[model samples]
Every structure is written in structure tokens, then in C-alpha cells.
Target: MSKIQHFAFLLVEEFSHLAFSCAVEPLRIANLVSGRTLYDWSFGSENGATATCSNGSVTLVHYGFDAIPKCQQLFALSGIHMRNHVSKPLLAALRRERARGTRIGALCSGAWVLAEAGFLKGMQAAIHWEYHDSFMEGFPEVNLVRSVFVADEKHMTASGGTATADLMLHLIERDHGYDLAVAVADQMVYNAVRNATAEQKVSLQSRNGMRNRHLARAIQMMHDHVSDPISPALIAEDIGISTRQLERLFGKYLNTSPKKYSMEMRLERARNLLIQTESSVTDVALSCGFDSPGHFSRVYKAAFNVTPMLQRGRID
Candidate 1:
């Protein structure tokens, strides 16, 4: 019989409880269905005791970084504000474990930690979209993908949330077999097992309201033309509506003025470019449709409470 694959989860503060649960429950259910311990897992924290999750819940840890036991795989689990949590000791321990040949993976924003430890250089990684901008800025040498999960060579990374479940299911299939993995998914009532190519966030249509096709088209246009935004009047003309009618539609459905919404969209794109690309501030500003770098700086600072230089520096 094959030996059970030992797994250790390194949990950080504000870790996503949903992601952690999704990652572990599949293994537990797989073992139950297989009638043997195909997988063994434990949790570890920085302090060897307990760590609080983002949702105000706490999970007990079986060990600390210093006491991490031998394991076939180690997955770091973290969430919001991940950049602020990495310490010298944690980075050293992760590097040491990697040197020792323990296959390491990350869940959600845990990729941020891995990247900070300099483990993801030149490797494909996935992180939550909310942190995509900052992560890109911080890990310029790493290859970032928009997929829900990335499993390349030896490293595994997930964009977190339900993606964790899908990754765990993939692991189960690799270990037990496809049939068993399907059974586990059925037991959990997971209708669809998302593959790595799946997107992390919901589609714009589903997120914005199902019936508003005009709003959907408007949003799509905004996304497409972030670099050269169309005027609200032009957008209204293209969508075949009067400017007043468009304003009414936005007011009723989106609760924001069309101009404000367009600015926000441009600013969001600028933020992504500021962090993801090595483009100069002037280039980024012009790319995002801001006529002047000074104007872009003012708007960016107003939106994110930091200058573009400082934001980029933080990632560095």
C-alpha cells in the first residue's frame, strides 16, 4: 500500500477560512471514501498555537514554523493584507523547507507570501484579483496568470475562495483516482469541478444584474477602452440611448453617475498598469487616459491614499 501523503498547512493571520476548509475537507472526505488514510494533514501557525481568520474565527495550530513536521506537501494559507505579514523568520523557514525538498504550495493570497520568500521567480502563480495589482508590482520577476489556480512543475498556487476546493480535488484525483475524486465532489454537492483555466471571480453579467443588458454592454465598453475612455455622451450614443436616459439607467441600477463610473474604471486600469507594468508614471497615466501625470497623481492618491511611487515602492 502506498504511504499516506502527509500535508501541513501554514496559516497566517487573516487567512481565508473558506479556502482552508475547502482545501482540507476534500482530503478528509477522500480518506473516508477510500477507507484508508490516503492523506494526513495538520495546521501550523507563526506562534504554534492559534491564528485568527479573516472572518473573526480562530483555528488551532498543531505546530509552528520551527516545529513543522515532515510532510509530502506544505500549503501556505493566507488572505487580505498578506504583504504586511511576511517576516524574516517566516521567509527563512520557507526557504529552508524548500531547500529540504518539501513541495510547497499556496492558497489565495498565500502566493504573496511565497513570492515574498522569493520562491515564485519565473514560475506561474495565481492570486486573488483584488490583490493582483499589488502582487504584480511586488513580484515583477514572477509570471502571473489570471487563472483560478496554477499547477506548474513543482509549485501549486490557487487564487483562493472556491478555487482551493478545485485544487484539492485535483490533488485527490492525482493520488486516489478520478472516480474517487468525482465521488468526493458529488458528496459535497459541488455541481461543477472547476479546472485551472476557470476564472476566480463571477462574470460581469452575473455580478451586475441579470436583466440589464445595456449596463452590461456599457461595462464591457468601459473595460475595453480604459486606455482611451469614451465620453459619457459618446457612450450613450453608442449604446443607442439619450444622455439623460443613460444617466437614469446608471442612477437606477448602478447608483453612480456615468462620468464618475467611467473615471473609476479608468483609475482602476491605471492602478493595475501602475503595479503590473514597468511603465513610467507618465506612460501609465497616458495609458489610462489621464491627460497629465500631475492629474493622475492627484486622482490616484485620492483613490488609494498613496502616491504611485510609494505604492510601487511598497511592493518592491
Candidate 2:
């Protein structure tokens, strides 16, 4: 038998319990199915003994930041409020681990932590989609992708939730063999296992159950230009369709017009920015294409029944 490989997880405050389970269970199943000591794992936290997840559940740890044992790999796991929890000690621990030549990775918003430690400056990484906006704004040097996970990089990353399982299964296949990985996945009854190249979410076309290429192109254009939105006529013209046809497409499928849908998209981005970043209300409004904060506030209240300031305030 090959030597047993050890994995250590550094659980940050407010880590995702779902991601934690997905990351560790596959290894356990692999050992059970293989009937050998193929892998071993342990947990670490900022403090020595315990870490808490976002769902308010506590997890015991085998080590702390100051004394993470030697391991083949280490993964940092985090979730909401990830930025706030990135302390100096955690950064120091990650840097120390990397200096010791341990392969490092992240799960969920934990990429933000690794980025903070300067380990992912030019690495292609994945973080949960909800964090895409603020993460891009914060870590422009990191090549963030929309995939469920990125495994080929020196530092692997999973976008969190079940994507962590996809990554773990992939590692199992790499370390052992495809048959054992399949057996482990079967043991878990996870039929729709995705690869690293698979995107985290279904495409808009799939989500809305439509295959309209023109509609997809238009929506992509809108998403790509949320900060500096263009008119519906321009979108239609760019997509080689008439503005009337564009309006008709939206009306038939989304039950809204292009203008309304675009406005809603911008408002949604504005709301995310308010909750996820430290941008002022005026800054968030401008970032989402509004010129005047007062106009933005009125439209925001009309749409969500609360002002942008209040939205940010609610998070505290």
C-alpha cells in the first residue's frame, strides 16, 4: 500500500457547514470503500480547540493556527463575514504553511483568505458566486473563474457548497483511481457529480428553460455591462435583432420587458454591493449606473421597499 496522505483543514470563523461536510466526507467514504488507510485528515482553527460555522454549529479542532501539523495538503474554509474574520494570525499561518511547501487550497469564500495571505496573486481561483462582485473588486490580481472548482492550479479552489464535494471526488480520483472515486460517489448517492470545468450554476438559458440564442446573448450583454448599462435598442442591434423582437422575447419568457429586466438586474447588483462591500450608498449607486444618489434611493425603495443605506445597515 502507498503511504497514507494527511490533509489538514483550517476552519475560519463562520465557515460553511455544507462545504465542510462536502470536503471531508468523500475522504472518509474513499477509505471505507478502498478498505485501506489511503488518507487521513484533521482540523485546525484560529484558536487551538474549536471553530464555529455560519449556521452557528461548533466544530472541534485537532490543532490551531500556530501549530498546524505537517500534512500533504491544507485547505482554508470560510463563509459569510469572511473578510472580517481574516486576522493577522490566520494570514501568518497560511504564509508559514506555504513556506513549508504544503499545497494549499480554499473552499467557498476562503479564497478571500488565501488572497489575503498573498498565495493566489496570479492563481486561477474559484469562490462562491454571491461573492463574485466584491471579490473581483478586492482581489483584482487573482484570476477568479465562474467554475465550480479549479483543480489544475498549484492552489486548488472550490466555489463552496456541493462544489467542495466535486473537488474532493476529483482529488480522490487523482490520488487513487477512477473506480474507487466512482464507488465513493455512489456510496454517497451523489449522481450528478461535476468536474472542475463545470460551472457553478446552470446557465441563464437552462435556468429559464429556453434556448433562445438572441435572449441569452442579450442577457449576457446586460450582465457584462451592469455598471454602464446601455439601451435596449443597442442590445438588440448588437445581437442582430430588432428592439421589438427583444421586447417580445422578454415579455414571452420572463414576463417583463427588456428595460424592466435590465433595471431589475442593476438593482440586484446594487443590493449585493451594498451588503457585500464597504462602498457608500452613493458609490454603490454610481457603480450600478445611477448618476444621482437621491434618484437611486427612490428607485431602490420603489423596487425593494427599503433605501440602500438601510439595506447595508440591516447586515450589522
lDDT of every model, 2 decimals: 0.81, 0.86
Candidate of highest lDDT = 2
lDDT of 1 by residue, 104-169 (tens): 999989999998887899888888777765676677788777677987547899999889988998
User: What TM-score do all the candidates reach, one by one?
Assistant: 0.66, 0.68
How well is each residue in 35-135 modelled by candidate 2, as lDDT tens digits?
99898999999888999999999999998899999999899999999989999999999999889999999999999998988888888899987777577
Best by TM-score: 2
Worst 10 residues of 1 by lDDT: 201-210
Between which residue pairs do clashes occur in model 1? Answer: none
| Stretches of model 1 off by over 4 angstroms after superposition | 203-316
- Quote the lDDT for 313 in model 1: 35
